[model samples]
Target: MEATHRVLVVDDDADIRDLLVFVLEQAGLEVSWAETGEDALAKVREHQPDLVTLDLTLPDMDGTEVCRRLREFSDAYVVMITGRASETDRLVGLEVGADDYMNKPFSPREVLARVSALLRRPRLGAPSEPASSVEEPAPVAGPADAELDVGGGLVLDSARHVATLDGERVMLTPAEFDLLRALATRPGEAWEREELVREVWQGEFIESDFLVDVHIANLRRKLRRAGSRTTWIRTVGGASYLYDPS
Candidate 1:
């Protein structure tokens, strides 16, 4: 059976809202639309959608504020839509917990593609279950076996989609988790922005380097919040990032 993912489209423009609804519905997703940030929050509370497409400018409040509020009680994937391509704007969106961002004048095809990619990502903090009994067969190793213990009390459990720092759980968006995983898996290797994008976003062509930078910033903030003193992810030159425990 095809999974019926629910998406909440939050935009003030009627044309954009209708267009998003049409495209998302055509893509076999259940979509709900809202014209303001307040309405979007209400709909989110009501529907508990799997994802939300939020516009930066809204009648009641800014999208970043909405995203901040959403993160308080919701884990829904948030994709911010903005007309401005400013680095500050992108960083703010990510800082407030937006999972992704899209610049304005975007194609419905691109929107659908982004939505599909976000939906395909594994849910954060979903842990794997152990065998029921000793008699039960042990699970075979696979991609999940690539888990890493990145020192400084940080552990990345790829199989369970969990990250812990100093024995405290570090909540991360799927993108942030993937980014950390990619860098931690190969510590001390400087990863170019393009390579990190391909690995974390699964080959999606992200046009702006700011996307990767913003997500990295968010990841760092989360690590700090988890009481980490060492800089786990480091910037190399002006272009690449690497995992350096030192």
Candidate 2:
């Protein structure tokens, strides 16, 4: 449970830091703090927390950059906390790999709830090797557990947590893979964003429609970058998305 989890709270405001630390600690979780992005990176490297509460306006660097850097070495659940409550700010934060985010003036209980919900899910794995590094495609093995080789140059193995496109490994974030798998498992089915949130997050978090959209955008981009011959996913009249390997 989250009570046994480790969390790093990164914010320049000492009062906010103290408040978050107190709330998290009261819930029986080990907590730490950092005032700068550099310190946050150092702390993450040293301690490897299960979750991080990052302030978007860090004195040393932008929270998006911190999250981008953190994604390289760790997949800790990042909750970008910001004083700005604009859609553009949320988009930027989500673009950099924040699993979730919230605006300022939030209740500590909500943070704890979000944290508990996030920690309940599997950690998004560390980022894969740079696209330039792979010299050759690894040969695909026999049919895998819960395999979904639906043609169209994409293969998803749910049990093994792998996705291959055109016999080459498709670099995918864990969220992207989960979303792809959910859609691929039931191809041709229109999945509303809310339904995807439930499928991917297992109904642990709500009000995550944009999170689904952002990750879906990322997934489609990666699929194209990986050389899919055609669209493996498509949107349903701007309302939802579905897997369409044709």
Candidate 3:
């Protein structure tokens, strides 16, 4: 039998949590729900879900922190749901490594669609093979000479989705690593916000462009925490961003 797609739904609101569990289960996915970030993390480690629907506001910890923490272990897909409509919130969520975002009072259908799109995305950071699967494995970093060398001190195992900076392993969520690789792989190319959204988030379409900024901010924070330099992702005009390999 084919493996079931497991989804972890995290929200402080009981109604929203239950509603998502019902809707996602009805859609044929194996669903689990958590009322807090701590609970969500425990369940995530236990179940190892295929995808996650996370509310930006959680009781124990903000959704952004949750996103950062999860990246340390699992490579599951994350879609952040926020009650605030502020650009800062959207940007922050993305920066913390969310794969996608949805503002509150959102349609269950839209939420379902985003979840489906993310789930359908090519299985990232895996070796390439036949093209029959719904999502292609993330492109590998092989023996190419022309590839951006972020630094000889750092090695990114793209296929396995791991990064080692200065011989010490650092943790990143799948989304975080993808963002880093997208920027680092090119090294000096100026990647506009729209370009990052399209390239880093290839499967699903982001409705608001500001979402890119939030993710970039989050990526910078995490990389900084890992003691890696993020000067490579240069911001331009408060509108666009680029990667400087130099």
Candidate 4:
């Protein structure tokens, strides 16, 4: 028998909390709610949920900060649901470790849909225990073709949910790891943004082109920070991204 999937809903508004809880519970998920950032963090630490729905505005702290702090200890997928709809806001949200972003006045059905998409696709490379979060920075290299064992000593261990650079662990989000695996598996293959969306995200959630760009950019930043000496992943055109081992 499979274990029940758990979700935490964090919003300052009681109505929104109730709505999300009701919707998720109706969908056969075990749901929890928190009304403040600190409480949300506490609940996450305690529950070790599979996902979190977070509002950008919290009474105790900004939602982005909450996410950044959460990333320190938990890799639970986060969806930033807020009234802020600016490009800057969305980018910042994603940059801080949010897996997805949604504007306010959203349909409950759409919220359910995105949540369902995320829940359906747990970390493909998660470990036996939990892919809860990335370990301390051991950044190394990217993957290569065929078994992701190429790219100048970059190796990916899918069964273990780890990618190593010169044998150093390169911490990656589940999506980031999947993206690297896709590129590394087919070195020199230029994938259009739309195609990538389908490839990585399984084409289940409705998303704009920027979603791919943001994730790719995040992947790049992490690799660079991990002391990568080469730009392994590159853009071929306005709409295509590829991994080039050479």
Candidate 5:
């Protein structure tokens, strides 16, 4: 049977830990608390929590290092909580692979909202099968569709919704995959933001072009991890980003 959805709350303050546990449990999630980075890692190894709320100031290891190490082992969503609100702090956390951050003295309600959003956000490449069960679908061939090789040691699998880099699977968000496919499919053609909205997003729901930028940034990071560059996408203006095959 699948286990209950778990959240790991890592903070040195016992009161805050208990409070988070109570709130998260009330919100319908299993909760585990750790008082230090080492304990947090151990809990992650033991329970494999679906999400983690990490305190930046750890007694032993720093939160940034903890984040890097955790990413090495799991793809669990991490949200950084700290008293430091410097832009540099936020940037470093993100650069090291944190998905979100919250400042200390934060409202419990806000914390709960962020937790729920992180847990509910749809992940790309997630198994369509029931949770904890492995189901492999039979491969179905695509029609005689045009193939465009996106070099940089990457291969695109539009049919299977997969992307591999140097023979290793590269994980991407759904929006990232959709953006990459849309840009790469046309090779040399540059796509304007509105065009991408109509084509990739299938609607004009996104109000700002930053939506495209955000997804492109995420996609570029994934590609870089695969030892490649997004030399394909070019920025025409604040409103347009184009794809260049070469």
Candidate 6:
């Protein structure tokens, strides 16, 4: 039998918490809940859940801070829940390392669907091998025509879900890595926003195009921090984004 995926639901609203717990439990996941950001962090540390449904406004601290802190040690997927529907709010959540965002008054079914979709996707980190194994396994090529060398000392190993710049590993969120991999696959191809959403998000419905932009921005930031001097991912102005390594 497959191991049960764990979820940490963080929300101060009693009704919302109960609703999420019910829906998630119905989905066959091991669900836990916290009423504050501090408690949420504690639960995360203790349980090391596979995913977290975090409310942006928490009594103890802002959810973005919680997300930032969580990213320091955990790569578990985070879906931010916010009462505010502003683009700025969503972008802030994404910048803080949230894998997805949902506005207030969201359907319980939609929330469950998002959770299910996220859990179904593979994470970026590689599994550890036995200490006695001296030889490294050969890198496997992805469907995008082998690993992409995006110049500027950047290499994307899709098979191992690893990205390296200047011979150093570049830590990326699962969403960022997927977006980069999708663009790098067909360099210079201006992929439409919808197409990218379908490809990277696996057909999950995103309410706004800003979701893509936010993830793209995060990807660029991480890549630049990883020591790449040139701009690789570029916007096409009213069209799409392309991986232009020129």
Number of clashing pairs per prediction, in order: 0, 0, 11, 3, 1, 0
Candidate 3: 10-residue stretch with minimal lDDT: 125-134
Model 3 TM-score is 0.72
Score each candidate by Cα lDDT.
Answer: 0.78, 0.76, 0.70, 0.76, 0.66, 0.78
Model 5 stretches astray by more than 4 angstroms: 1-4, 122-162, 171-222, 225-230, 239-246
Task: Pick the winner on lDDT between candidates 1 and 4.
Answer: 1
Deviation from native of the Cα of residue 81 in model 3, angstroms: 1.8
Q: Is candidate 2 or candidate 5 better by lDDT?
A: 2
Candidate 2 Cα deviation (angstroms), residue 228 = 1.8
Candidate 1 lDDT over 54-131, as tens digits, reads 999999899999999998878888999999868889888988888788888989767866776666655543432221
Lowest summed lDDT across 10 adjacent residues in model 4 is found at: 130-139
Tens-digit lDDT string for candidate 3 (133-187): 3342344234322223467466666656666767776666666666777777677
TM-score of 4: 0.85
Question: Residue 126 error for model 4, in Å?
Answer: 5.6
Ranking by TM-score: 6, 4, 1, 2, 3, 5
List of clashing residue pairs for candidate 5 = 190-242
lDDT of 2 by residue, 1-246 (tens): 235678899999999999999888877788999999999999999999988999999998999999999989876778889999688888888777787777788886677666665555444333222111112222122333566787786888755567898788886655676778778878899999877776665434346777888888888887888876688888998979988989
Candidate 6, 1-246: lDDT as tens digits: 133678899999999999999888776678899999889999999999888999999999999999999989888889999998688888888998998988889896677667766665555443322211122222222443246687777888765567888789988877787788778878888988888776666435575378888888888888788777778988998668999877
**What does candidate 4's lDDT look like per residue over 77-143, in tens digits?**
8989989868898889888888887888878677766776565553534422211122211222233
- Report model 6's TM-score to 2 decimal places: 0.86
How high is the lDDT of residue 233 in model 2? 84
Among residues 3 or more apart in sequence or in different chains, the pairs in candidate 1 whose N, CA or C atoms overlap within 3 Å are none
Q: Against the correct fold, how does model 2 do in TM-score?
A: 0.81
